[model samples]
Target: MSTVKIEKGQAFWLADPQEHDFPAAYDYLELLFVPEECKAFVDKLRGATTIKKKSKDILRASALPLLPDTNCHVKENLRKIKKKEKLSPILLVRANGKLIIADGYHRLCASYYFTEDLDVPCRLV
Candidate 1:
């Protein structure tokens, strides 16, 4: 199953920044596609649409590239999520009508690999 039902819209969550495993160097580039952009974009999208979608569907909206190879971090996140350790909601941004993953790509990949029906919580900016 996919996450979003269509190509023109998406779902997301939004709020002030909270530190995670995200690398510090990302702060500089955050203005682009990483985290900051998602928040900014979502805030702009506010009130324009209200959408909810499954994890797999959201991934389809992103059209993100495959990881190519699993890293120790991704493998660990997969194990944890499979075991029911709740992960933080993913962060996403809209650009040219496409959902860009600003964070939680690994977690998304893991969830999709196991089940497309997973409810992925996200914050869109």
Candidate 2:
């Protein structure tokens, strides 16, 4: 079998889906994404791992910190905040640079008004 390797220092990039694959995607919003409030606050979160070699390393191998998901109300506020602040696409921090969110899909469909996309920076630890 030929092995397809995910290079070191690379992350599995997922976009903010503009259109969900399912018709009933919003039927169970809570189950799709976890609430941020439920997470425990960590005093110190570790930084991203720097790649030294060509070997592949799964991110789960390291203890990563989780940033809270934006809430429904706050998500709406992001839209207003974006208009007022003139914020750019959401920036997700990486060990190398930032990932720009091409879209804030859920917001567009009125699944939830506002944006959790504003001022939110994310990094996979």
Candidate 3:
């Protein structure tokens, strides 16, 4: 697993997605897809290999507005980053010629606060 060492210390990412992240992804995906499809997507995400991608590129590809510092989730992720905690790799799905952030939107936004060029770990399917 690759770690992005920010000025404070090493902001590490887990080699595999956290167990809870899969259900989170499935839940979020349900908002966009049927339950059965959501499960399939989550399964694919689970089997996907971890890859590094630029944080800015992901935001652009997903067409998601960056959550501001005041966002509770973003704030929490920022705290984790500052404390040098291990973060879960994001889960992504490609559909309709667009990118969907299945999970870890807050982490991506928090990492972007440090540097848009930061290479964030993701399990893209």
Candidate 4:
């Protein structure tokens, strides 16, 4: 996965701005008509909804910066992370008002690859 570094006081969703195109490659895996196994998996997702989450409220591309010092090649693992990218839109839940990464770690990394940023879309619940 793309290296990630969290900084203080920055709530941003680094994303693949390319997603603005709505690429077919990004659709196949998340399509509702996919295989039975896939459908079952989708069904298990938390808080599935048709409502469009506010994009403005979410973080944008360009938060994460390049890795420091080491130049290790972790591309293969990163590719795998991208393939499993979720469409259900990971939720950052709060039990008593603490932010958490409920899901979408891969998407977070993928966002970094597409944009040198490490921020990612998040929903507070």
Candidate 5:
């Protein structure tokens, strides 16, 4: 994919998620839900429209810790940002008043490095 030109510390994102993102999300969701439930959530996420939210807010809602800059995955995402490569929109599941990051946790954490107020694009179900 062609890289996007970022300006003023803004991160770039693909207009829609990559095809592999769905299966990756399903694989992760399976850990928290039955296969049937995972399938349903993936289906819903596939049809969900992209929305923007602050990276810090998502972390707060999900109650997930921000991975450190030393993490391998987070480092990779940071490299992508430095290279001006577009990142895939994150996939999320909102249940029981919490947000589950089905995919793109590393990306979110990496984006937080730029700014906690950074607006992240995501598909939420």
Candidate 6:
């Protein structure tokens, strides 16, 4: 995808859709997925394994182009890391043989920068 497209995608997540301000994201959100369907998809991964691997490992596995630096999100995440706050695990969805970071890209980058070998907990969808 083009950088602009990726940025738009990132922005969609950053906007916190629960607040209900982004019509662009809300427009076809239901069409893209339904709760039951998404639940079924996760259920199908019953044998899925959750593992901790190097931050860089996931970046390589993602096969996705580097995301654009939007706000100071990464830096903010890094600050959190510096403060030693616990970060939630990143979620990944495997689609068409590529790992898409469904959430927590900034946290991943910050963890990777702190230490390339930082163990990041992740699970596939």
Best candidate according to lDDT: 5
Model 6 lDDT per residue over 1-125, tens place? 11111221121112111222222222322345675654554443333465666788889998654343343877676556555555656666676576766556776776665555667776566
Stretches of model 5 off by over 4 angstroms after superposition: 1-6, 9-11
Off by over 4 Å in 6: 1-37, 42-49, 65-71
Candidate 2 global lDDT: 0.25
Whose lDDT is higher: candidate 2's or candidate 3's?
A: 3
TM-score of each: 0.59, 0.18, 0.91, 0.31, 0.92, 0.60
TM-score of 1: 0.59
State the C-alpha lDDT per candidate.
Answer: 0.55, 0.25, 0.87, 0.36, 0.89, 0.53
Candidate 5 lDDT over 20-50, as tens digits, reads 9999999998888899999999999999999
lDDT, candidate 6, residue 71? 39
lDDT of 4: 0.36
* Best-performing candidate as measured by TM-score: 5
Better of 1 and 3 by TM-score: 3
- Candidate 4 residue pairs in clash (backbone atoms < 3 Å): 13-59, 13-60, 13-119, 13-120, 14-119, 14-120, 63-117, 64-117, 64-118
Which sequence of candidate numbers ranks them by TM-score, best first?
A: 5, 3, 6, 1, 4, 2
RMSD of each: 8.3, 16.4, 4.1, 11.7, 4.3, 10.2
Output the TM-score of candidate 6: 0.60
Q: Show pairs that collide, candidate 3.
A: none
Q: Write one digit per residue (lDDT tens) for candidate 4, span 57-79.
A: 23332222333223333344244
Per-residue C-alpha lDDT of model 1 across residues 13-108, encoded as one tens digit per residue: 233233552342244226666576644554453322333457778878888764522666567666565455555566666666877676678767
Ten-residue region with minimum lDDT total, candidate 4: 16-25
Range of the 10 consecutive residues with the lowest summed lDDT in candidate 6: 8-17
TM match of model 4 to true structure? 0.31
